[model samples]
Target chain A: MTKPLLTVEGLVKRYGEHTVLNGLDLTVREGEVVVIVGPSGCGKSTLLRCINALEPIQSGAVRLEVAPISRESRDLPALRQKVGMVFQSYELFPHLTVLDNVTLAPRKAQKRPRAEAEREALALLERVGLADRARDYPRQLSGGQKQRVAIVRALVMHPQVLLFDEVTAALDPEMVREVLDVLLDLARQGRTMLIVTIEMNFARAVADRVIFLDGGTIVEEAPPEEFFDHPKTPRAQKFLNTFTFDAVKRPHPSSLADPTT
Target chain B: MSIAVLRDYLPLFARSALLTVRLGALGILLAVLVGVLCSAAQYFRLPVLQQLSAVYIELSRNTPLLVQLFFLYYGLPKLGIRTDPAVCGVAGLAFLGGSYMAEAFRSGLEAVDRVQLESALSLGLTNAQAMGSVILPQALSISMPALVANVIFLLKETSVFSAVSLMDLMFTAKDLIGLHYNTVESLTLLVVFYLLILLPISILGSLVERRLRYAGSGT
Candidate 1:
């Protein structure tokens, strides 16, 4: 019954002859955690990028809170202010300190005073237990720490929705847990999030709905339990089967909630 | 080889040194300004400027510095465009150095992960703000060693100012040689003067290079 916070309608994106996203449509209500998983090169990352307006769609529309998101119709920076995206390769500004990195957008885009920006940034860093590392540079931190700092950077803007484009893909196996814990905490805090990840367990634990995409279209969508335990589509079954029996497995992504509760 | 030669020429050398420093500083500054515009134009594919930048970079980079100097200093006068010799010489160096500077800048900008721009945009920074605040700084750090090397090259090449009749260090040395016929001594003194001016800059360049080594490569 609540208003949808985000909507993607008949979205189509292409790179020359190849179509990366094809006539995709979805809607998310406020505070829903939607996880997208598919085989490599299946347009999962492109879909998230299109939502953020980083990749311009060839047709269709993306809207946030009843407003159309288009290059011609909107002030992009202002639109971006409402939707924050964290990249797969933690693109932290290497030249600035971590504190500066967190505060740059607030100071520049929102024109917040320095002390106010730093104060807010410090609190967010403290939330992630990175307050002590505020003075360190991006190069000084590990992959997990850099991604965590990146998450805090996005949070400082108080965006309406957060997008993660495979944020844990670059991490060491040991480091993935630290970053996922942050995501789990954000989900528990009731934030609206769209995550593109291969961590089957994390999706199974936190996703309000799991979307299995193949060849640029959603093959199946359901609650995680139903989707994982009983994938209805042949494409979904095949995709999961490939990962189901690999010997060199990624460390298992721990569970988020105890279903019995 | 006596103390008198050193003492007598010190003031003149000081003045010539000042002149060289002033011209070198101005030329390098102009080169950097020209480089920023040219490389940005190329990156954005700005209509006419991009083509102009490409032609200018290639022409300047390929031609000998001496010919460019002669063309600007001498050829322009006959075309009813007389300009100051110092202006012509500085413009020439800037043109030549800027071409190389643009290459350095282009590479540096490319060295950055393209994802950086997307992230910056998502943070609500406008394209200009993203390029200026986030992208340009990393590019600068990566491009610095090449830029500094270009500057050192410019300082040495400013010796060509003598042919243009500009009062650069090499010009002053030529005049001293003409007056005293102490060719070896005067040239040796000029070399010392150049070393004194440029060695410190070389040291600073290396220091900066060391600091920036690991900064731009982080994820």
Candidate 2:
């Protein structure tokens, strides 16, 4: 088989004396949807940052198209252009209008004409149902709207791989669905994605593979259907139990016990 | 308030006020330059530049503006580097005002969401591009009020240039007052002279603060 579109090999990251990602590895095939679910401190966010070279790695490598992305690598900038990332906080450039924010990467780094970049940005905005808000600043958008715009911002780069780091964790309950629909649409279009998220239902529906990470390493990896139905490890089982079954869907996971019982 | 008495003094007041405006403008320009350069050095953490910027900020901030002026005007001459009084005065205000501006900018830059940088990097922007496009604009707006107030402080501080015999506001007024022995006229006119210069700048500063107001999270 051809190499995965992106690969993490024995990645290690540390903050001072505490290691956050320890000898962890992952591979994302082209057009594949991978979801990473973990407790808060399990190094999910650090993994994404290290992939984009946003955080320094203590050891190992993050490779894109078989080229290593490291601090000293001359191709880091060019590699960055190929792997787009959407931040957890919906970190849109607040001063720019939604159109400018979406077009900034293409216009500046890609050296595309501003007018051309903006025209493409407007179409992406339209796809995300934010076409009318092209002129509005990030401050004016709701959390969901901002996240969609951030997704559009990343997509406009036409990257080979997309990384989502808890993309919907900060949104209101009502707002979360809209952002998930956008991600789902991205997946349907065959975009390669590595998502760190807590929205279990969205992950259940959208992920090709679900990864359970604990204690700085992936404890279990399986297709979402298999992982959700038959969690392999105690950590995975305990985490799934913590979900309140609050989402309105096929009768709550354990709520509809057999009438015979 | 005789028209003819005012007419006779108008040209002198105007010349001195013009001198004051030039010094204020030049001093502010230099302060902005120093603030951007030094604060960026601190932001990037360049070794020798950061250390020099720290020393410059500390030494200029701790010393009084008047003392800095004397040191530039008198002390420097001892080492055979003589500068004109006007040069000394403008340079002194910039030197002093720059330290405060740097502090204002450092805090402003810090207040910008760190996540913005992370997002920018992930999008393929170089560090400099990210800072110029995302960070500095927000920082300037956030730091505007402090920057303006410090500039106003420098404008007022220019009055101290009279001690260095720069022929600025106070020096010009002192000369005319002593020449005329008309304390009431000279002092009253002096007050108006300072106001005429300061009021417009203060108003402009407020307008800028209002214009660049971050409409994002009020935090």
Candidate 3:
């Protein structure tokens, strides 16, 4: 558990003149779940992207296990294979059936046997409750089902670490639970994951450690219970208070209890 | 009187239509191949190839196919490059058709959401693999209607092949009108033969577009 499976040191990401992630540093040990909470445009998503090497950084380095991941890295494909990422849009390959989407990378990139890849993909799809949708295209699936298929697609890669960039942000209310439940199951299984999300209750329920980020930096990091009940920083308290205020002030008192949950 | 002349020229019209189909198919095949290559060069931003593709597309599109065939068959002989009339016909049609096909593919490639590429990269696909397996299929589907339109345009453009002396439908029509003075009958036969070759393709294009629309509905 103490072994750092993934590490980001002083990562600096900028688009043109605007800097998004400013000298950020973080580490994720093997079998740990870290949930990141932040306001929109605070660089939570940027940090995850930099770690996955999907976005190039101006400075600093990201490492999975021992090897550094960078644009110049000779083995970027192999390096990226070890880091699975799920996007908020559930970017399943729209042209492919769910099974084909899940099996594509394994068979094509890794050069695995098609039958073997399909078998593993079917098992993962079954786990995500999408086994029946194996023949269906992305357009045929609902939001929750599509996200689950996306998760299966990532899991089929057998990555050393996973990054979830607001995975449930775009899902409808009822669909949110199905996706979060999948994440909670993965957490219970001790999968190493770094998640960026605004769902405070899900963050509290699943995080081993909650990281509060603001203005391109970490403002606070603590255990879930401690951070949720008794945030140390004034900024953290104010952010949490907004969620509470929104919940209390809303006119609809119907099934809106703990709205984020 | 016209019906009797049309019956008399049926064999000549059939032969001419066959030649036209063969030439049009060859030209469209070459055009599609060139189009995919040029668009790929633009999409991937290949060094000299991208610029050359841009120049070729502009030059080919701006000039007429008849002018291109004339240059290939007539003008090139002065420069000691006498190409066969059939080759000139196919090449001229390809030159014109390639630019339109490339533009169609480029638009389709651009319309694909950026997330499609990003997600493929996140899943460990190499740039080539992502483009080939993920991006190209979606782009091709999106480009279907434009490609069908280009195919029809190229086939119709095959009418100019007769100027280079290839004995196509237009040449057969002109020869019959000159010899027998049956202009209406020859032109009617020409129209019917062209429809024979083009109507099936138009119908097939619509069917494919509907299927693709169904598959790509929510996307």
TM-score of chain A, all candidates: 0.93, 0.92, 0.93
lDDT of 1 by residue, B1-219 (tens): 756787788788778888888888898889988998899998888999999999999999999888999999889989999889889878988988899889999989998878898889999999989999988888888888998898898888888887888887888888999999877768877988999889999999899888876454675
Model 1: lDDT of residue B206? 92
Model 3: CAPRI class:
medium
Residue range A140-168, candidate 1, lDDT tens digits: 99999999999999999999999999999
Q: Write the per-residue lDDT of candidate 3 for residues A115-143, one digit (tens) a residue.
A: 99999999998888888999998999999
Task: Please give, for residues A1-261, the per-residue lDDT of candidate 2 as tens digits.
Answer: 445899999999999999999899899998899999999899998888899888888999888877899888886777898998988788898888889899988988899999999999999999999999999888888899999999999999999999999988998999999999999999999999999999999999999999998888899999999999999899998899889656535775565676654
Error of 2 at A85 (Å): 0.9
Model 3: share of real contacts kept: 0.64
**TM-score of each predicted structure versus truth:** 0.92, 0.93, 0.92
lDDT of 3 at A10: 91
Candidate 2 global TM-score: 0.93
Against the hidden true structure, what lDDT does model 3 obtain? Answer: 0.90
C-alpha lDDT score of every prediction, in listed order: 0.89, 0.89, 0.90
Q: Which stretches of candidate 3 lie over 4 Å from their true place?
A: A246-261, B2-4, B210-214
Ranking by TM-score: 2, 1, 3
Which candidate number has the best TM-score?
A: 2
